[model samples]
Target: MQLAQLLIFLILFPLIAAFFLFLAKRDLDRAWIVKLSALTIGIVSVYLLISTYDKGGLMVSGIPAEPTGMIMFILEMLIALAILYLGIVHKKWLVVALIIIQSAVMLYFELVYAHAIHVQSNLFIDEFSNILALIIGIIGSLICVYSLGYMKFFHEHHPEMPDRRPWFFAVMFVFIAAMFGLVFSNNLLWVYFFWEVTTLCSFLLIGYTKTEEATNNAFLALWMNLLGGIAFAVAIVYLAMFGNGIMGLDELLASGKIIALIPAALIGFAGLTKAAQLPFSSWLVGAMVAPTPVSALLHSSTMVKAGVYIIVRLAPIFQSTFTGYLIAMVGALTFLIASGIAISQSNAKRVLAYSTIANLGLIVACAGIGTYEAIWAAILLIVFHAISKSLLFLSVGTVEHRIKSREIDDMNGLIVRMPKIAAMMVIGMAGMFLAPFGMLISKWAAIRAFMDAPYGFVFVIILVFGSAMTLFFWAKWMGKIIAVTSDGKNIEGEVDHSEWAALVSLAGLSLITTLVFPLLSTKLLEPFLMENYGHVAQLSQDNIIIMMMMLMLLVILPLSILIPTRKHRHVSPYMSGRTTTHDMRFSGSLGVQKKTVLSSYYLTEYFGEMKLKTAGIWLCSALIGIMFVATALQGVIL
Candidate 1:
């Protein structure tokens, strides 16, 4: 009964809420619906977490299979038809063809190939699923709540555009539902169904504005994901044909030894697209044009996450193979290049987007390594990155609202303009690369894990350089925000409380999670690792102490800014004796007063998008080609 209730709450509740939110007409109605739904989801997710913690894990089987499979099949068909319609309307023949092919392939597989396959357990619950549920239900719902405040300003900023807040909120809830289903299901077919739902939701949300650019970018996202969907479909077919009746994730994992290389390679290819790894990363970068909450949801907690989640799920199967090595190298290359590219970007959201890609690359690398420690690092990265990135995206969105720009230069001395949000941004930034934070700890573990792998030095080199690039870009952004300049504006009260609530909660989660890293590692991550691998990876006590010390600095540094301080003396900039004003200005040779200005060094000439993107895309494409060729060769040999 408890399992049934929890499952319904986690999987079904948001969907029901989505229907109500879609019908909501007034702001008041949307507000109540979003708040109530968020609250309910949050409560249920926490309850589920507590229950999972108490039980260590839970697995429910013997669900009525026929009806569920039929429903999933119908929904998949509807989603494909919807995509086909959009493709035709947009005149995107590639999308239309891909959907048609995927639909036909899925139909034949479901109706013919998998007609007699009886997957014993359709739903599986464990620590990993529980963690993802917590992320999707809690962080995802918070983003929904954040959207409530953000969409108002969004429309205000673009009065010329039609209001689609109802549709937007409804899709957001639907995304949460889809994510819940994606993580919880053990059956591959069910996972694929939810996967398509997320793809559809992202398409709808990305194209919400319906501008030509939004439409084009949405189609790009569509066709690329459709390509992945085709790969996923092929993988399912291959699995059904060659898997010796292995129909579910558990069975596949259990029978990892005999699984064919083709399905794994196809699935990895699918994951590459979903995670927005190089070659497919342009879609995520383009996603910034969508609303900030959409960026937060897609990049941080939902869409791109599904990509890494699938790769990580299949990690055990890919471990130690030639295909695995290629996947790891691809991830490492992406990490190095994406971080380098971030150095050239001035758009704050784009920087965040690139950083997200880089971090997901690291996670993918860890998954490909597929050792106990590597998988541990991957899961930890997932948890930490989701919290920290969501906070940063929300912070950037709020900052954009205040300054009317998303550029790093525009954020100069944000310490003075929006001190509270700046402080939150600082925490979020520090969490991304600084010590004592979850991301840094996860990276540290990843480095160690890579060191233990075969031919690990190559990955180590990429990771080292990538970490340096990460530091360079993040520090520059941090300096821009916290810089003390005379020309500062105060814009504190302009932001809504709804935004503040979500930001503060995420900021708090970042810090608290950092503080409790040891406990989390011990209780959640360690047990999961032990249960799966029969051993647990341990962090050194000395490192733990250092992490605690750094965490203390993280807490104090932000608080120092918030608390009033009289100990420091203020001084004006030391201009030459020819100073013309109290502000930093100087008398020129021609007797004209010139205001002083400072800007970040972007080095666009060296690290420009045009310089790096094409080369990186080709390199990653070549690597993917190698992966597939090698997989095919292996299959032929076997």
Candidate 2:
């Protein structure tokens, strides 16, 4: 098929499937439909990548304009009406006001600014977007497939709650479709439309249960993202009015920061909100009340990723400017504060959530630097974080269904109860932790880039300290998963096949992506960078060798554990005083029988979530205030 045809298929087929899935209430039929749609989407994404890579880049032409534009406008109004209805019905006046402001801005922009200016390329593809497309298509579809099993089990567990799998699966597909549109959209207007679509989908999915808390959290998400949406609309209007009427991404970038930085700052502010930096992070934490699959999709592949994609896309304009420094500082503070907060989380998903925020902060910081090395590092972080974080979230989901809790303390003996899921979770943590692993090489690259940047010391200090704190939380969680015990029984056999399929696929992907790191850099990443920076970033031969060597050590160390060892006399595990081999019991006062218990040291006094998060919000709010004032002053001079 032609490239445009494939783009159309990739974008439209999911919506078609979503409609069908919404209608089909039967369990068996929904399963087959999701599986078929997922396979087709995943394959077509690969084909799209090959076609785009062959051409280096391509833009779809002859796209139906007036009719397509009209359809989008109608759809936009419907979305606004839906959100407006939800807001008013729920007595969420703030949400109502925000949606009205954004919708009004959109209408004004469309009638006054958008109509006269013609955008020849509404959809385009390049190597960078291809990477995001693959993540959305493959990883995202896998998440949907996993949801098939998870939602069933969820319903079984919460028999008190109504089954909303139809709505759940349909919204998941729509989210995937919107993401595909967002990454491929060349026109700023088209991007905004898709952006709002994701916001709507996330709101629906987060509140799928219709429970009071779920509904409240969903509205919180809606308002925060809608705030970002309003900023996005204003940015587009600013560009249209004063940016030589340039609404296409390429045209905006060509106009340089002289014309684009102000709007870029506006959109960058939007990115900060969506990406869940500092104060905005409460929305994502609230989203955890939704199904695990929704959390995985939002945190790993779709909503938050879209936020950073915009920042990274606009990196060129922010390069060497105060806007970049402002972004870099926000990202830096976020990384440090979020990492500290993760350490205090006893809930496994909350730990993952904080980690996601912290890592995205690092990626945002890199994008803000906008150096060749930093952009390179930023993309790598995006790729690996998606795979490993998905695996971690899904693994935790499976564990939760079996163990009946997401508390890290409850999972103390997960290694004994569910080896398969536990092992995957361990690998996920290890891959993201400090080691010869997937996330490490990327941060190393970021460190190299930061070392050369202006105010480099500030970036370096935050990254180093924050990364160490990152290791602390993940190691604690990994320890819990791998902790051995005498009480738990094996339940790995009970995992649903669909969930296993996704978990195994993501786990394998995590390994494969690491194994192919060198080839990926030389073949895919470098060539892509050549287009923008006029050269490619490279690690020295020594550093490359060390990474490969460490990767080998990671492989060998695992195998070493699996290798059979010579039999030796059984010895009791140490538990304070004298311990018996059976039941992990130790002698206490008067030789009374006692069972020993070990718990993680959360250090809540130092890294308390409420304290640290509150401080982060206030500090980050101040930083954002400073940036806005500074950016507005610069704009006034023009």
Candidate 3:
């Protein structure tokens, strides 16, 4: 089949499958439908990659935009209506107002500024979008398959909650479909339409339980993302009115800083909100209240990635401008502060959430630098972050199912209790910050990129300190996993086949991607960079050999723990109060439990969530305010 035909199928088939899933109702039927659809989507995506790997931006054609625009406009209005209805019913005036504002802006733009504009290309694909397509189709489909077992267990565990598995499965597929449409659409209008669809899907998924907390967090995510939607709508109007009739992302960016700065800043602000940086980060953190699969989908491949995708694509215009610096400063500060905040978190999901926000900040910082080297690092960050984070989130979810807790303290001796999953979880953790893994490697590239860019020293310092905080949190979690507990019993048997399949697959992909990154850079990233930026970034041959050596160390270090060694006397840790002998437990005064417990030092006083997040929010909000002020002054002076 032709590329266009396959692209259409890739976008539409998931929606079709979703419809069937909603109607199917039965567990076995939903499972089969998800598996088949995921398989087809993955295969089609791989085909698209194979066929188009060597090509430049291929402008997608053959769709009738006139009819399509009308359909999309109607659908968007319907979505707005739904939100308006819900907001009025729930008394969330903010949601109602946001919808009304964006609608007014878009309605006016479509009726006035967009009437006669012609886009040379409504959709285009290049190596970057190709890679994104693969991530969404492959990783996303795996998550869907994994959800099959998870939702079953979820319903069994919470019998009081009505079974909404059908709607859950349906929404997941729809989210995938929206992400595909988002990355594929070059026309800003189409991109915004798909973007809003994702926002609605996420809101639905987050509020699946219909509880008060779930509803609030879901609306939190909704309003935050809708704020971005409003900014995005205003940006479209600005570009159409004063941007030489720029209506496509390509046109807007290609027009350079002279024409793109103000609108680009607005759009970049939108990106920041969607990516959950700084002040907007709480929405994603709160989103952890939903099912773990929802967390995985939003953080890793689909919702948040869309934010960085657009920002990274605008790297060219962000270079060496006040707007760019504002973007970088926000990102850099977010990276540092978020990492520190992660250190105070004991909940496994919260740690994952903060880690995600920090890494995304790093990617945004790289994009703001806008060097060829910086873009290289940003792209690598996106790829590694997606694979590793999805693996970790899914592993944590599976662990929670088996162990019945998500607290870091609850996983004591996980290696002894659920060895297979513990090992897999450890692999996922190592991929995040350890040597020879893609995350560390990408960070290395980011460091080098920052070394030569503007204000390089400041970036380097932020990265250094932020990276240490990441090391602190991940090591703490991995320690909990690998530590042996005498009370633990093996329960790996409890995991379902579908869950294991997804975890093991992502874990394997994590390792394989790291091993072949050099080849990946040579074939995919290098050529794309050479074509687009006229320069290529590469690690030295010596560095490559050293990385291989570290990879060997990664293997040897894990196996070395199994080697026979002299048996030493185990000693009980001393506590001031009554202590249990050799049990790693102690009873103390001041509400201490009867059992001795050694918990990780959270330093909440120093790195508490409320304090750190409050300070960060105020600081980043100030930065954003200054960003717009600077943009206005520049516009006036120019």
Candidate 4:
């Protein structure tokens, strides 16, 4: 198939599938429709990856440019109007104001300033976009399949709430479609159009419950993302009016040296907001109120990835400038503080949410550094983080359904209760922070890149401490899941097949990607860096050997646990001669029986969100202010 035809298929197929999903009434019909859609998308995405590899990136240009622009403008306006209605209905004055201002700026630009802009290439596909597509298609489809089982339980648990399953499924598919368009779009306005689509989809998904809390959180997300939308509009205006009227990414990147810093800073600011860096991070934390599939989608592949995707795409423009330094500082600080905060979270979903934000910050920092090595690290982080985080979220959701809680304290002896999910969770958690996992490998690469960059010492220090905090939080969770007291009742049969299929597939992917790290680095990462940056940063053979050794350990350790062993006598814990024989209880002085209890140390007093949130927010807000001021000063001098 031609590249243009493939792009059209990828961009529109999901929307068509979403329509059918919405129209389907029976559960059996919905299941078949979703499975077929996911299967088709997955197959096409793999084909695109292979095609891109063989052809070495594809560009479609110079056709339907005018009509595309008009269509995009109309769609954008419609989105704004919908948001306006939502804000007014909810009595959210700030949201209404932000949307109006953003829409006005966009209209002025589209009607007046943007007339001179002609995007030579409306669609550009490269290794970067191919990676993102793979993520969206594969991980995203798995999440959808998982939701088939999850939403059933969701409705069962909330029997009083109306079943909005069709709306949920339709919106999820639309989110996937928008992501495809966002990643492949070369025109700035087209990117913005798809960007707003994601923000709208997230608003609908987050507020799917229609409860007071869900509605408020959804509006909060809307306004924050609208802030980014406003910045994105300003960027277009700045580019069109002051920067040679170039509005396509190819043109902007090709002429990055001469392009104004103000626009770059504006776009970078938008990325920060979309990625939920510090001051704007509360929305994502609150997003845990949504269903697990929604959280998995937002954190893993679609919503937040769109944010970093834009920033990473524009890395060359901001590299080594004042704007770049500030971006790096904000990302590093977010990484550090968010990791610290995760240490205090007992809620499983919140822990995953904070981890997602922190990892994204690291990716943003790498983009800000904007060297060949840093870009490599950033891309690897995107890929690895998507797989592992999606797995973790799904695992947590399944656990929550079975245990009826998302609190870490409630998951005591999870292995004994839900052995299959507990094992999957262990793999997911290990992939997050342990050696031989893709995330840790990427972090190691990021540390190396930082050490060689301009602000080497400071960034390296932050990376070290932040990584230690990551280990602390993830290890505690791992211990909670794997801690076995007795052979508890198993729940292997209770989980749906669809849920198990997604979970087990993701688990395999997390490990398989780590095993193939070297090949992945050589084929995808190396070629991408060389093509884009004109050089490849070599990974030491020694590191590859170390990864191999760790892979061996990963394989062996699991088999050691699963394989049958010689039976041995078990004994209860000795409690200073007061221990009971049956349940490991200890006798009290008053002859009252007591059961022993164990809990994970959250260290809330030191690492609590209350203690750290205000400071982190203010510090990041100040850094963002300095960033724009410096950019403005540079614009003045230029």
Q: lDDT of each model, Cα atoms only? A: 0.88, 0.88, 0.88, 0.89
Segments of candidate 1 deviating more than 4 angstroms: 54-57, 567-570, 576-580
User: Residue-wise lDDT of candidate 4 within 1-638, one digit each (tens)?
Assistant: 98888888999999999999899877888899999999999999989888878455567865567887888899889989999998898899999999999999999998887677888789978888888998999999999999999999889989988898998999999999999999999888889899999999999999999999999999999999999999999999988888888888888788755575688788888889899998899989989899999999999999999999998988887777878878988999999999999999999999999999999999999999988888899999999999989999999999999889999988888977987788888888888888888888888889888988876889999999999999999998888877765556887688998999899899889889888889888888788788788889777899899889988898665454455387734567677888575665778879788887778888888998977889999999999998888888877776
Which pairs clash in the backbone of model 1?
none
Q: Looking at model 2, how many pairs of residues clash?
A: 0
Candidate 4 global lDDT: 0.89
User: Where is model 2 poorest over a 10-residue stretch in terms of lDDT?
Assistant: 555-564
RMSD, every candidate, angstroms: 1.4, 1.7, 2.6, 1.3
- Model 3 scores worst on lDDT over the 10 consecutive residues at 555-564
Summarize candidate 1's per-residue lDDT along 326-371 as a digit string, tens digits: 8988898889999999999999999999999999999999988888
Candidate 3 on 1-638: residue-level lDDT in tens?
Answer: 88777778888999999999999977788889999999999999999999997887788877657878778999999999999999999999999999999899989988997777777777888888898998999999999999988888988998989998888999999999999999988888888899999999989998998989999999999999999999999988888888878887778867867788888888888899999998899899989999999999998889999999989988888888777888888999999999999999999999999999999999999998888898999999999999999998998998898888999999887877877777777888898999899889888899999999877999999999999999999998888878765656689888999999999899889888888889888888888789778999988899889988888778655454444267634566556546655556566577475665547878899899999999999999999999899987877676
Clashing pairs in 3: 585-596, 586-596
Q: Which wins on TM-score, candidate 2 or candidate 3?
A: 2
The global Cα lDDT (0 to 1) of model 1 is 0.88
TM-score of each: 0.98, 0.97, 0.95, 0.98
